[model samples]
Target: MSFRKRSEVVNTRGPGLQNARGPTQDSIQNARGIPANTRGMPVNARSPVPARGPQLNTSRGRNVPSLNNNNPSFRGRLSQRMSNMNINDDSNSHLNNHPGIRPSPATSQLTTSTGCNDLDSLLGHMGLPLGNSLLIEEIGTTDFNSVLCKLFASQGIIHNRLKNGNSQQESNTHVIVLSLNKMWGKELPGTYKGSKKDIKKQNIANEQSKISVSNLNEQSSTPSRYKDLKIAWRYGLKDEIGQKNSKSTNQDSTEYKDYNHQFDITSRLIPTPTSDEITYIPTNIPVSSILTQLTNAIDKNPTKLIRIIIPSLMHPSMYSPNYFKLTEIIPLLHGIKSIIKQNESRCVLLASCFTNLLQSSISSSKLLLNQIQSIFDSIVLLEPFQQEMIQLLEKSYKTQPNKIQHGLIHILKLPAFSEKGEMCVSRSEYAFRNGRKNFEIEEWGIPVEDVEEDENKDNNVDSSASNIGNPNNKPKKSTKVDLEF
Candidate 1:
């Protein structure tokens, strides 16, 4: 075979049978010129590039290129934009400085006190929010729920008095009581003052302190001239210090007026509310007339905070048997609810019902109660202690009278109008004591003595049985000999 370089090899085939070769400069130039340039210019000639059309922005039409090129962190730019925006949107403008209303510690919504600090705490909001209704259902015939209604009414009147401060003009808080009782104003509780014994103890303590100071002064001997000279200066210093302390204490007390006040059930509201501050509506009237009157009250006091108190709801004394019909009661309540919703910032409703009166055997009565409870934003069921439970409590708290509980409080449902939509029903058993000075709610628990007795009994039995296992313990020998088999 003849040795020949692959590059110089020639084929004897037709002219089309050529070997593949690398691109030459002339071939590359021809390939580049194949596409016609309508501008009729040389490829290498410099020409002004046509201005680019607006780019199709896929990122919601944002300037993504600039954003990405300038700052890699999008969150930083977002924070900068947020910093320049107004944070106070003022959606709750009506909540600002409204009398008798305070922002809830839990939800931060505008709320008013229910006149009982413990009851307020039980509601989980620390107070009752405006535009919502609270239905208190009691099982017994005792009128303990009526006491709460009075407190609710009195709180409104007191708030009105405090707001206007001796002004004869109409008050800013209006209390509308749905009852025919003319002496309702006189029945409201007054602010609590400590018992005589407590006051006496305080006075005695003060006297003792003064006596000790006087003794200390007497024990020290000083020159008469110096003593006389320093007495005025010392008094002057004391007076200055006292004035400063008083100013500080006064400032602290006035910093935020208490949202709830402690009331004494034994005393009546002094200088009862004026006619302008409270309105009594008759519940015996037709439901339509009641709705009309409610509407008129709301309309008349457009600028005031109205507190509606419906005490003893569905009681035979307050309402006729015909009023119990679902058609009549439902529309009445729905109307009141609508009014509250319309003036959410300035209205609140509190009503009490007797669950014992509702016949469970009758489906309609049971349904009526359920529907009424559903209408309210919150439902609290109060079950009074039975005779047996009462005896136990009395015996347990014989020495500590103040610790005795009168009834059990069941939080069936709490208001769910907050932005978080949180609904909480307290599962833990809670006991309530309706005291003369306050209505207290506390965690329910068995007495310590009872628990101790139970533990002692178990321990005694265990100790006796455990002695059998002890190696140190000896068993008694039988006196009589066993019979021989």
Candidate 2:
């Protein structure tokens, strides 16, 4: 069966998965919507038989939680179950029995006009709940943005298919891009524009991939960085600073170092002086008009899985100000969550922090943590693993086993199903709620013990400079000389 190409056309019949997953996994669909294209959700079909596994027989001698920590009676039963099932890393325990995971009364599937049955299977139910937010907070950048974009794209695809009165299985899903950094052009959340540079700069072989760097400073007042006025203003600022203040000590030097001056792009954003020089967008944004297009998409796809990924490649500080906390991003986030629900798709909202944030002192109103939290259904702080926290997740799941029932099938579901199929994966998915409340950075500066001398030196230097400027021709001598030297 033929499908509509990118130009857009409607077709009433054919197999959907065959196109994306190659001809093998393809299943034919008649006049109705078909299955396939299920990138985000999990396949819940009860396998008629256990899938084959290698002969490592790795199931035996499982580290089974220690007796000290695990209740003996429960542990005996749990151990017996584990022995019977023999869960390994490769094998999924869905086929096995569990006393804890009971089906919800609302477990029925939501039917869609879209022909894709796989989408439903992957999503468990047809859609995500209203106000449900999936936050993936991690330090590493691997596959983070890509996976998120796909999730958002998949959601949008389903929504569009339903909107068209056709099955998503039967039609093509298009998540128009609003703006971004590092997205592949193939599908979901649309294409990724490497950098927002002009065509000339884009041609440069070594031009930095925007996603590789992170911006720490994103302004709240402005919308688009590429705007002409913003760019011009930024250029002027840089020129002025280079000439006059390059050697001068900055008042906020402490704050700058707190972020480690992360311009090297190891884990954060690069600072851009003006809005227009936002030559890179690590978000893989599909559209050129970053700000306006994103706002528009948010308005359009409340029920779709729309991802506005501000990758860690950009300077965190550079982008944070324009992020949800800075502007009216609440409406956009609400729209995003709403659209996913309306369209019967799930939404994943991921925000990455840069070195700037780490470098900055912890202060109220700066992180805007609470405001950002309200935008999401759940939050995950993906950083280095802590053993105590892991233990907590395990304990919580044992007592409240049903907490992550739907999560069992979701691949990225935090605290995923333990390797054994028993509830083991710690869904510290709500990382913020479960995360450390007080995380601070320590850096030695001029200790307070030496503060008096330093202050005296600073005052003396300032006074001398003032005197140098007042010799009748102070404007010429102290006129902030544009040091040609």
Best by lDDT: 1
Query: In angstroms, how far off is 469's CA in candidate 1?
Result: 38
* Candidate 2 Cα deviation (angstroms), residue 348: 7.3
Candidate 2 residue lDDT tens string, 197-262: 744556643343333322213223443333335436787556656757644654323322221110
Say what the RMSD of model 2 is: 33.3
TM-score of each: 0.64, 0.28
Per-candidate RMSD vs. true structure?
14.4, 33.3
Off by over 4 Å in 2: 1-131, 140-169, 176-178, 186-362, 365-367, 384-485
* Residue 174 of model 2, lDDT score: 30
Scored by lDDT, model 2 comes in at 0.36
Native RMSD of candidate 1 (Å)? 14.4
Over 327-422, each residue of candidate 1 has an lDDT whose tens digit, in order, gives 888998998899899888889999998888876424588788888887899988888888998888887887798998888888877875422465
Give the runs in model 1 whose Cα sits over 4 Å from its true position: 1-95, 163-170, 197-255, 360-363, 417-423, 450-485
Clashes of each: 0, 67
